[model samples]
Target: MEITDLTPAELRVWRAFPLNEGVDLRESADDDPADGASWGPGRTVRAEVLRALLLDGPTTGGRVPGLKLTGARVTGRLDLMYGTVDPAMRLRSCHFEKPPNLYGAQVRALVLSDSVLPGLTAGTLRVGIVLRMTGCRVTGPVRLAGAQLSGALFLDGAVLGVPGARSGRPPGPEREDSGERPEPALQLNHATVGTDVWAVGLTAHGRVRMDGATVGGLVNLDDAELHDPDGLALEAETLSVGTDLRAARLRARGMVNLSGATIPRRLVLSSARLSTPAGQALRASVSTIGELWLRGTAPVQGAVNLRGAQLDLLEAAPEVWPERVRIDGLTYRRLSPHLPAERRLPLLEREETGHLPYAYEQLATAYRAAGDEVGARTVQLAKLRRHRRTLPPYARLWGYVQDVTVGYGFRPMRAAGWLLVLLLTGTLAFARERPRPLKADEAPDFNPVFYTLDLLLPIIGFGQEAAFAPRGVHQWLAYLLIVTGWILATTTAAGVTRALSRQ
Candidate 1:
């Protein structure tokens, strides 16, 4: 073929060449002496044919190599829609100043790595293939919305600069149908990434939304920084990562909502600081996690909400949590009544010793429940005593004492002594009121008091009634005295005999 300026029609014919039949377009180009520009030294003839090659054919064993398009500036969008490359297509160090659209382009083997795509000013750029951009820098925001990736999407050490600059034409705008209002950066949604995905050390000026993304392996965002107010460092919902989701030192101003997500392995968010509201910090709601390990000294100004989350422990072993787990203001109001008496008692005692009056009040209520009125009264008295001691100086004017007089037995000793006196007085009155009866043979003229004394004198002299009688009574008295003298002697003898026997 002669060296000539190829048109779009001629370029299409070159792309339609059969796989087996080879068409070599290498030719020596004569120098344009008038323009003073060399042509054949580093000129690539196959570069012109690449813009027209519709990749609508099968990529069973296809191969394209030695096709250099270094610093190729495409004015309009270059669409490689539904293109298939079976073998490796080498685009080493190729630069795309304009946006090179590769939407739904399937590649069976390796795509070129380390390709630079800067200032890609196109809306809704999608790469639905095994696209690998290892160490590639995207100067502007690039959207890969709804892109299904089978292989790994490695963007390690890629610098994603802010969108607008001094240039009138800025980067591509985000997708409008993505439900996210106009932001100044890239967004990846519903992107199924197979194998390990690494975007470590990738900087994003604006929000980098990856909602509903699923990664097969570990998704690492080791040391990524975001410098915007509404800048979301990561907003992945239902993000399914296989192993670990290590995101250390990830700073975000807005909320990092990983709500309703399932992390099979450990989800480490160590040393990540957020300076937003309590509602906009780290949120993980209703998430099922194996172990959500958080280490390092990460200061969270906002709340770390993990409500309704279930933590599962598979193995039959003890799990330790050394960190201070505080559940402050966690309301379990329905469970308060159902708490056991033994458990509630300790809490009540803790409150009591802490000088909480409510604890003693509740203890009185508990005693009432147990039908212990005395115990309740005792506790109430103790509370009153404590209140008196803690009163202010001005309130201490009324020096009232609660007289707690305790007696060993039932009544006071003075009351018991009065009862005994009443009993003795009643007995004496009954004895004086009763009439004394005279004996059948005794005279009625006899003085009752003198007769009683005379009867007592004879008994004192050992039953000598004859000695105390008158003349015929006096003669009887003399007889009585003689008999009394003899009886006294006999009685004295018997008393001595009884005393000796008792000994």
Candidate 2:
């Protein structure tokens, strides 16, 4: 390749290489690299040549402190560890010979759009503005541990891969011998982004970790493809996102762990796909979010654990719910309008050992607040029945009695209905053959209705039974009436007490 064959854009970078000043590669004011940025292989920029230029102080003339080496093929690793580069590095549409080592480097804004690198070791890298990378390809892992970005960390439409990609490696990509989980394809462990961490249309072939990272804006991964098969694909534990954590249309191969994450806004996973056979597909245990929407999304093969999560609402279809999602401690105020308690209660029936009673209690409370007392009682009854299975034999029997008699104290009217049936049966049975008067001087005749009432009402007894004792079949009938009264009275009291306490 000769210099004369270089394009205008290539020639500009060649001419500006010696100045060490940050160069803007945009040829025209209306130019867009995302559309496509063309590059030529006419010249190759060595690592030492660029390093010398970057290490030197500013010239006597007024010049920007940043370094820009766009549209050039560089040979050798760019090591800027512990070095202070006064200006931003906008290396767009460039190819690196080796990974750039910027461990603990300080710079202004950092942009590496439309470039190719072997890997990146940017641990503790501090950027004043943004650390943005878009439309780039990296063969190895990209680490950003302890990094602090004043602006967003954009890796949109980038293709990231893991070098060795062993079955079960340790964290941070450096420990391949430990045999733990593989390091994230794009690691941001404890990195704080002032704005967003936009990776829309990203294709990563390893774990994506943002543990303890704080994003002031959204963490959008819409249409992103991530895979780690036997391990976690996305681990954002303890992450704090100020706005939405949108991952619509995301296709993740393994578990997506967001345990203890805090998102003040919503977590939109509409149409997203996540699958993990070994364990939970999505673990948001103890995470706090405004809302979670999984509308029309792909079903997860494994459990989606949301234990201890606090959210404003949950939007998910019943049929599309995961096989075993643990919502034991999920504190959500509302379900989607399409998913009333009648439809959504089944999803809470996860946790193979049986769901926690509080889970059902919370859902019933939500239904109750929505002016659906019947629905609330329905959920409450289910909770009681499910919880009964976990109790001792005696308690379970009691729960059964309560359920059949008064719907576990939810149907006090059932108890009253039984009382009315007993009263009617006794009155009608005794009316056929009234008890004969034992005393001839008895002034009042035996009233069948009053006599039946006296036998049925256990709280009060009348002298009718003592005055005229029944014979044979009638004697047995009287015994039956007395037992019926006792059963009704006891159950009615229990039901009334339960109802009053519920209120």
Candidate 3:
């Protein structure tokens, strides 16, 4: 590039690139390039000059090459598609006239901290070092699809997809509509990052997608706000992470999808306030995580679908529980707070979704593993009651009888109580009237207590029932005693057998 063709700012950048020296044009630290209209020709650097320097600029003998500039206006398109740049590029506190296109390009390090860009298009770009965009304000989508980064990808305190208020520049096109479907504000689909993804305090107006992306280290999104009212706010389906996916204190306005993802470590969402009315708030179905933490004060407005999810531990708070949830095939080895079965039973009692007998059984198993026999029994009894609601009228009637008499085999003491009550009633009734002896020579002594015992115990013979014959009301009383005894004994046996099978 000719020296006459470059502006004063571009000349400075050109002189500093080979020696890795930084060029700051701002008179003061507070002088931002947001008001690019105020910048004269001296502060304007053509994008062609930058591309020229990156591709075939003069090289220093041994000094490291870099392009570090601050507080300038970048004009025209800085298109470096499919090119390989060796220098580290750091453009802090700068304003871009157009979005830099680095599609399929390979670079060393790229840092654009506290800068204002219309958008970014770095799809399939490969970075040898870090890609930091902390405190940046972008007005459109930041596409990084299929990008391979050897170091961390930082977006801490960055704001994207918002209109340019102070810059007076028109915001980038919100969507590149193709086949009627809009693209996401931040797309990292199928990207591979060697280290962590630090996105703390990130605010995006549209969906932030990371579908099928793989990260070697943790992905932290603490205190982030994602708003996509018409669609998903954060769609991370099949996102595999090596460490924890921590998103504590996150506020999302649409559904967050994590279906089919495999996070071997913890998936923490503590203190997240999610709202997606008429849709699911957090749909993590068919995912596998080491642990899932949802214990916080924030409320979730929509249903949570955890069907077919496998977790080692599910640590949740009752206050943050969603009103409706589908946990049909959710298998968690443990639950948090060690709450009683009664307190947790409501989770499985979503009658509008029909009976969840398997869910109740899972809860029972969890309680039993924790050595809470009473809690396990409580869960089992609840399961039976819920199942009874789905039975036919006659079957339900019989179920009611089993429930009242013995708690559907869960309350063994009820059977004993019934037996005591019947024994007392029969003894008192028989004592009031005595039956005549059938034969004076062969009959035993007329003992009312022994006679009542003989009539009530169907399997045993006390020699009193056969020896005496009762008449009138007393005869009818004997018949009633025999029938009642059989009913109680049979019910008690059936209940005991059922309870034993559960154990």
Taking all chains together, each candidate's TM-score versus the true structure is: 0.49, 0.86, 0.92
Cα lDDT computed for each candidate against the true fold: 0.47, 0.77, 0.85
- In candidate 1, how many Å is residue 206 off? 1.9
Candidate 3: list runs displaced more than 4 Å: 163-181, 435-457, 467-481
Show where candidate 1 strays beyond 4 Å: 1-48, 53-76, 85-87, 90-92, 109-114, 118-129, 163-174, 178-180, 277-279, 312-503
What's model 1's overall lDDT?
Answer: 0.47
For lDDT, the strongest prediction is 3
Instruction: Count residue pairs with overlapping backbones in model 2.
Output: 2
Colliding pairs, model 1: 466-480, 467-480, 467-481, 469-473, 470-473, 470-474, 471-474, 471-475
RMSD of each: 25.8, 4.5, 3.2
lDDT of 2: 0.77
lDDT of 3 by residue, 177-237 (tens): 4443346778898999999999999998878999899999999999999888565889899
Ranking by lDDT: 3, 2, 1
> Candidate 1 on 1-503: residue-level lDDT in tens?
32245554334334433232223222323222112122232222333345444343222246543222222222345555456534333443334434555555554433334445553332322333455555555655655656666777766666665533311223334333444433545556667777666777666666666777778888787776654445344677777777877777766666677777777886766666655553446666666666565555255655555555544421111111111112221112111122233333333232213445544555555555566655554454455445655777654432121212111111124333432443344334323432233343552443323332333234442222322233333344334434543433344444345335524
Model 3 backbone overlap count: 0
lDDT of 2 at 71: 59
The order of the candidates by TM-score, greatest first, is 3, 2, 1
Q: Candidate 2, TM-score vs. the true structure? A: 0.86
